[model samples]
Target chain A: MRKIKDLGEFGLLRELGLFGQKLPEGWIGPGDDCAIAPKSGGNLAITTDLLIEDIHFRLSTTGPRDLGWKAAAVNLSDLASMGARPLALTVGAALPKNLPFEWAEEFYKGLRECADRFDCVLAGGDTSSAEKICLSVTALGDMEGRSPLLRSGARENDDLWLSGEPGESAAGLLLLEKGLSGGKALEKCLRRHLCPEPRVELGLLLAERRLANSAIDVSDGVLADAGHISERSGLKVLVEAGKIPMSRELCACAAKSGADPFELALGGGEDYELLFTAPPKNREAILEIGKGLGLGVALVGKVEKGSGVSLLGEDGREMEPKRSGWSHF
Target chain B: MRKIKDLGEFGLLRELGLFGQKLPEGWIGPGDDCAIAPKSGGNLAITTDLLIEDIHFRLSTTGPRDLGWKAAAVNLSDLASMGARPLALTVGAALPKNLPFEWAEEFYKGLRECADRFDCVLAGGDTSSAEKICLSVTALGDMEGRSPLLRSGARENDDLWLSGEPGESAAGLLLLEKGLSGGKALEKCLRRHLCPEPRVELGLLLAERRLANSAIDVSDGVLADAGHISERSGLKVLVEAGKIPMSRELCACAAKSGADPFELALGGGEDYELLFTAPPKNREAILEIGKGLGLGVALVGKVEKGSGVSLLGEDGREMEPKRSGWSHF
Candidate 1:
């Protein structure tokens, strides 16, 4: 008789996930933002992301345009994780009755700005009245002729790669929550949290070159998301804690706020970066791709023949973390 | 400086509709659930619909299963309007944290049931927490080499045909609101209000045989939806008030509740029925298609060389309705 809140979001998902288990042939995953069914000749990847006011964000900390941009960005980030070229996006918004028309207009502007930047179209959506704002964005991507990078494709002995820094977004959220502002690093973290970019180009490059074995977006922090790949692929993902990438801004902000940088980097969520696995042979190529995109790429971990995720301290031993990651419920 | 509430949903849509207007080539609409781009050898139609608790439905009157069914049906109805064969659907839900896990299970069951019946796969979705339950469903359909039936294709002198009765859903809602239960007719209205069947087969038939010139599903009431066709097609839709179809259940429920059946048929929303325009020459064929599907079809109006929607009284004079339609705002 436990409620969903007691079960938590992941438990509820696990319970309900049994329904959509019978996916069509050639489909990727209910586990990895499934390919669903093939459209025409190309594989189509679709993912929906929901953001509720107060739960996912606060109107006080987040502006209307940034809220809009982040909404689209998060959904697109799902598409990017699958190595799919963005095609179209639809937004379903439930806004308060008293919301300004100008706010909505700016929201759409940000949505379109992100969609346009990612070579996707803002096709259509629904608008409704709600007590609090709730936005749902569904993004569709074309895999073209490339095979979709799935979370279940990782293999033992594969190198685990991560793009961009992971902890800045969580650090940025902390600063916003504590009403701490000022300083260049703090401002950068705020922007990182507010306007997180999707690695669409890197995903495409990986898919095109057939470099990645498995991939997932780092939304629920590195530990939880890596655990996703581990669970799906039935392999262990071991991360070298010292190798975890943290931006200069994140370190600076963590120092100023007296927060654990490693904790934020590992367990804090809302980092829309990509974490993927590949053979060590492709390491040079991936590094080249990252350099081409002018994005920070790092070799953070390795896949082994086991299960779940583990973080190793600088001493090369397992590290017990205070928190693993975030759960919506 | 007007708020969106003052602007209303339609007015706000008009104001913010300027962005995303420059759709890629071969795209059908920002107007008629636009085919943003061609996929493979077919046209892809996508639409998103949002249903918020208290605004779109009341948890007291609606069960979780029916709520799930209606959420899927409304989106499928949009695909039906476009004469598109539904391919897949993604649901984005923001549920109250304290909701029962069993409720979510039943909801997914109903969602899958409707999607399965319509030959659409429940591919993927996002789940999050909110104060109120808000469901957003995005439906994808393949036109399969047939030209998408746009809302702008209705021409002058075309016969405007409607499938099934319009007021039943509204009448059903009336019954539910008043908590009037008992008689078979009243029960039917309540069922209609709770569970609506999307006309997927009929839409496919219309598209496959090229019968409907333009079409739109009536969610915003027949009069309001027909107005969409009229405005998009650059033609006037003249609906005979007397010809507005009402089910036997709706009539009985209206009489007992002392509500006007015509008003309910014209302005009461959530019909989820298809209202379409076809050339006069195709009337017989269209009727035959309806007969084959075992669906009720009514030639309710005609498309003229004008704009907007007009309801003519039995005396052949234009009648002013008490309300044009339901607005979310």
Candidate 2:
């Protein structure tokens, strides 16, 4: 396990910068008082997210670096969902009295690393005292000339697609909770859960190429997130259960824990994968985008002229999961 | 007190829009993914702040509308300190479990009100669950083709000035904490404490006219925030006790509480006024701008070729306040 203090503040941020590599159009990519990005004709994209201690993470299970990374990632994910490129981030942190300065520095390092990776800079933020640590990150992005891809844009007959493997984060969470480890494979899953990557590059590719009709990030499980698309688009979506992708490590863990891999794949959260839809004509173009970016592209379902989301079981029956995944409130 | 629930989600935002009438140059003012602003021809000005329950405020005392207002104001205050004009804002809210939907609506109403007042738009944000309510707001601003006014810009022999009354918010807080209720005067002070308005217009005027050599908002307190200027600029500032302006209401409350008005004015936080310095030549211009804005401006101090901040006591002796103000550790 990596301790946040091991990297210090600046060191951790340096690591985060490594992951955020692509720049969206019109953004002067971070490292300033504010990020300037060209918007829909000159409009900019801005979003914020807040994560609380105990409510958002437990220190015993999560490290400071991961917490900081998650804070920025969640906000950036919102920008991605809107088809915006991240430019700058500002953070507000409330630390408990007992928190060490070194810990705070490490936390900032993680945040800086993540911001730099996306070519975004840590502009400025507020710090204060609290009984528990709390973090809030606001991400700014450029919209360029593209219309933001909203959750409401999926029309009837559009094809729904996902950017990468689903349910891996949830599987990692399950493994962490049970104290079960499977060496390198389990390590990868657990890392995915703790430090789920935001699909900013893939989102930008879709927006740049005008391939996605609508897009969303799978933060709260495939079923629930897809439900958002269904509700907003006023359309029905049929997802084939077997077609949902799962890592082999996740499958093995599910089998060992007596959990259904398919169920986890559908109902797990924190995947941070891009879930989008487009016309059938865009299929080949999107696939080519995936190949260019070295990301997996999966066509999972289709949009129909009705409301609600359904699942197709192996027996050719429509099925609903026992739960609808996680909800903030 | 206005409850956040009184306004529906979108209604509250609409109410907020009423306040955002004026916009600075090169700003894609409000209502997008992010606010876009040009700083120094190419740079941008960004800042973020977070407020949480039992940390920044208590619901029993502070109204939800005020919370929303303060969240945006604090971030805007940071931009003002940098001599930047408000552009756009993003928010991240974490609501408690079993939270009423109306609470969020009312909060957004307050947020919208503040943003609109500052000509800022609520761009985009994320909402999630928490054990307590948390708000994180990030404000983007334009530097108007000039370098941002950093804390390091003050030079020796510069004249120090303050816009509006100081320490009213802190005085207001003392009254609230002591549960000391007076008449309308106390009520006014309490309101000031609850909702400290950021001096955005004045800041812009100063920057536009190039009247200030350096600037920062009176957030942490006069002495502490001035200390940032001193540390960064490597110059000492001698603040005149008599020159520090106080609202009549604040003075009256302080007298009743047997508190030193000067001490409160120096060490109390959340004033949200602009504290700036300029060469002696700019004095007339500064005064003219203040008059044009109908704002009360005062010459409070002078920057000297030394390090540290000092107060000129009535006895002609240098005095330091017992407390330097709030420190977020």
For candidate 2, give the DockQ. Answer: 0.21
- Worst 10-residue lDDT window for candidate 2 chain B reads B27-36
Q: Which residue runs of candidate 2 sit more than 4 Å off their true CA positions?
A: A1-42, A314-323, B1-42, B98-106, B144-146, B314-323
Which one is best on TM-score?
1
The list of candidate 1 runs beyond 4 A from truth reads A18-20, A320-323, B18-20, B33-36, B317-323
The digit string of per-residue lDDT tens for model 2 on B1-329 reads 34223433223333434123244455433322123345334446776666878767888788778888888888788777776777767666666645444455567778878987887756545555666666777777766565566666798899999888887778888888888886877888788888888888887778777778888888778887788678768999888888888789878988877787777788888888888899999989889988998989999999999888988887778876454755343
- Poorest 10 consecutive residues by lDDT, candidate 1 chain A: A28-37
| Candidate 1, B219-317: lDDT as tens digits | 888888888898888888899877777788888999989999878888888888899999899999998998998998999999998777888889999
Candidate 1 clashing pairs, residues 3+ apart or interchain: B29-B34
Give interface RMSD, per candidate: 1.4, 13.8
lDDT, residue B293, candidate 1? 89
